[model samples]
Target: MCWFSGLIALSMLVGMSSPSSAQSTAEPAKGRWTSLFNGKNLDGWVMKLKGSDLGENYKDTFRVEDGVIRVSYDKYEKFNGEFGHLFFHQPFSKYKLRIEYRFVGEQCPGGPGWAYRNSGVMIHSQKPETMSKDQEFPVSIEVQFLGGAERGTRPTGNVCTPGTHIVMDGKLITQHCNDSKSPTLRGDQWVTIEVEAHGNGTIKHFVNGELVIQYEKPQLDPDDRDAAKLLKANNGEKALSGGYIALQAETAPVEFRKIEIMPLDD
Candidate 1:
């Protein structure tokens, strides 16, 4: 070929292989991390407390103040096992959820002893409207959070299955709760917790950037009353892939500053 012709062909090849050209033609990745809690108000959230109707914020239990969403009971004279949940409006399939929380003051009087400094975020949860008027907890997977006591070792970032179960290490786990190896954060210290859920496949837990727990195959329990109805609607396919996210108000004062999620699917 002539030198001029060869040079022109090489220039065209270089142009085609340029980064800008490839980027313009490539399919873009989908999804982005977004703030679930507005940090200003509960604009996209609903409330459901045990023994009360849906949307009832018993004694104003859930509120937003100082750029934080708080589960407070200072106005109540007692704690009566009024298990409450503040649920996000949307449901998700595959995502990473992160939140920052801390225990404040003391557990309310009459609160369960086991509930001291205990609160959690429920994922893959049943809809609020489906829960009975007296249901304590919805069918979900709980990323259980427990503040450290002044005395002994109390782990945080544990897993608590309510009306559901998971498989770990290829074994079908039937335990109600599985403790993580994470260190206990005593007192009123801010702690960051994160969960990576891959639909009905695998789920993981991390605290302060350290991986503490991992499991797989989360499914609804047929024996659970609340979950039984869901099981039927799901065509008896126990695999739980998607559901709502809710924050717990289990007779304790807790504050959450950040609640965000990053979608995994396009």
Candidate 2:
């Protein structure tokens, strides 16, 4: 009888210890993965810049369907109007942003004179409410995603700082330029782009798991009008410490999927 009682107590003790043991031994979840898109609706996204209304009325430019956020030109008869931007609701200072995008369909009329059929992912972006009604686009660092038809057919990850500048290897790369090597996968295939942004103003751009571009301390050029505006809005600072993230709607139809972000702590 004593043996039976001992066994019962031992079983209960072992059962109780099981959860605590698992709690202590279980591995931690890998990297902080967060879904930027809800896959059901644009819950944490906002539309800004030249559509109609103050972003709420530009339904044709940005829309969600079939678990993807698509930037389309179906509603635009011509792309003569101002450019458009779709910004995430939250601001992230340092993190890895991974996005999958593919180009589809033809360019519309008045579409950037043949050089603007492409779209981009704008990082370190300023608030949209701070700009004037006639503002074409935000003054932010643009990770320019180009298609095959762009000027040099450089289907790679490039940089275009509208109201921003960056220091690379002790010199200033103030102008719009492609990366030293093209990191783009050509054709209509979907490409996975990853950007690792360090809070200290350093960033790395990756394409299909390969590092393509790296830079640090992006500031605004003194002579550029957009840079000046950004500086003024942010208390005369040349570079943004951190800001919002946006997807562009140029003149062509583009589709985005698997848009995810993971926050990193220093």
Candidate 3:
């Protein structure tokens, strides 16, 4: 069987809950549950990056309309500047974060490449303000979300880490991680992604009831180029780890619904 298929089977065995079910359990539950996105506006969120343009010009790039926090590139004719990241106000060491997202519209101009249509949910990221003035993108583990242009591609809830590294099976798995399986869903379908982050740096990425990737100790790999750059910019490599979380607005348009968080007590 394929790696992704095996991951799906593993997710089933773990009894992971969907976003809807998890949200349902939030009310009057045994533990504390918090809503990351206010749904009406970007209340508890902050945007920061390298350059003077902290975000996508604060336009419709990251905004809330109706009840959803949408990451749209409708205003941009193209993605010019460096990288852009939208982060939550609170910093999390360990927690279960659940988000619903879907890609929309066509690719923007000056996007990355074919992969530019890609966007990500960054976890275990550094402080937004601490980033360099010329920094492009973030040095965090990206819970990559992808859609298929063709039928039967790969499933959603893929994983990709940039300028980050984690431990898996006692081995150091540095930055640059991707799903072996192609996306299976296409068009504008809302897919659910749930992540369980253990404070010690262990994390699991799940999509639509399937576990796509597992990682631990999210920190700069020390071997990656960006990690090296960030190290130089920050004056050290230890500057990473235990920061905040952010969402990507690469060149594609995407929307996030039900962005909620439940802190896990270690």
Provide the overall lDDT of each model, using Cα atoms, as 2-decimal numbers: 0.82, 0.67, 0.64
Off by over 4 Å in 3: 1-30, 53-59, 180-183, 224-241
lDDT tens per residue, model 2, 1-266? 11111222333211111111111111212377666776766666667766444556363778888878888777776667757888776556678989998888887678865454478899877665554566777767788787775335465677778866787887888666656355445567888888898754688888788888888886656687755754544445465556668898877788888777887774
Ranking by TM-score: 1, 2, 3
Ranked by lDDT, top first: 1, 2, 3
Q: Give per-model CA RMSD.
A: 14.6, 15.2, 10.0
- Taking the tens digit of each residue's C-alpha lDDT, what string does model 3 give over 195-216? 8887655688787767777766
Off by over 4 Å in 1: 1-31
Supply candidate 3's per-residue lDDT for 141.
70
Task: Residues 174-198, candidate 1: write the lDDT tens digits.
Answer: 8999999999899898999999998
Q: What is the lDDT of candidate 3?
A: 0.64
Better of 1 and 2 by TM-score: 1
Using all chains and alpha carbons, the TM-scores for the candidates as numbered come to 0.87, 0.82, 0.77
- Residue 243 miss distance in model 1 (angstroms): 0.5
- How far off is residue 178 in model 3, in Å? 2.3
Better of 1 and 2 by lDDT: 1
